[model samples]
Target: MAADVDWDPYYGDRRTVLALVGLNLDAAAITARLTGCLLTDDELADGFAAWPGWADPFAGFFPLTDDINPA
Candidate 1:
């Protein structure tokens, strides 16, 4: 059997959340990676607005499905 604990406390630390998602980068590197996408202000707004409906909001700006494994 599995146990259930309140997740509210863990949500307060972004690093913990990102680590849970498999992204080990710190906040600054994450910010740089995201900002380096070069999305325009309007595009950024559109991405946010389309988020709930779109399965992947960043599909327009990034490749979410491409295999990145090196040979």
Candidate 2:
């Protein structure tokens, strides 16, 4: 599921969102750094909780040219 995400000032793009559903601390940490966030375990959990209904936890960035199908 990939729909328009809230615009992030740091990333400066609505499509610059990524989620790691199940990863170890090391991998998640690396990914967070790559994604420009130094998220704590709680923060990551919050992200999952706050995720939009139209988005999937495993979905990567979706370009504007693509269609978003949450189903």
Candidate 3:
């Protein structure tokens, strides 16, 4: 079972959220646009976790990256 979270309150600001979406784009073309921008590792990867879940609300599966190796 999953917890019901009031996520809207946490992301109330639209512009900031949009900017973050822009930052999360993985295209090579925008590499220069975000050049030198300071973002923590989590900031970079949070989109991956939040995206597919939101895009497919019923799906619980997510794609993991190589950086997170299992013990």
Stretches of candidate 2 off by over 4 Å are: 1-14, 32-71
Residue 70 shift from truth in candidate 2, angstroms? 34
Give lDDT for model 3. Answer: 0.47
TM-score of each: 0.23, 0.20, 0.17
RMSD of each: 9.4, 16.6, 15.4
User: Which residue pairs overlap in candidate 3's backbone?
Assistant: none
Error of 3 at 1 (Å): 33
| Count of clashes in candidate 3 | 0
Model 3 C-alpha lDDT per residue in residues 1-71, reported as the tens digit of each score = 12233335655432332343533566553454445343466765787565544444224434455765567
lDDT for 57 (candidate 3): 28
**Candidate 3 TM-score, true structure as reference:** 0.17
Looking at model 3, report the run of 10 residues with the lowest lDDT sum.
1-10
Better of 1 and 3 by lDDT: 1
Better of 1 and 2 by TM-score: 1
Tens digits of per-residue lDDT, candidate 2, 1-71, equal 34436556754555555655643457755575565544466766677556454335334543455555544
lDDT of 2 at 39: 48
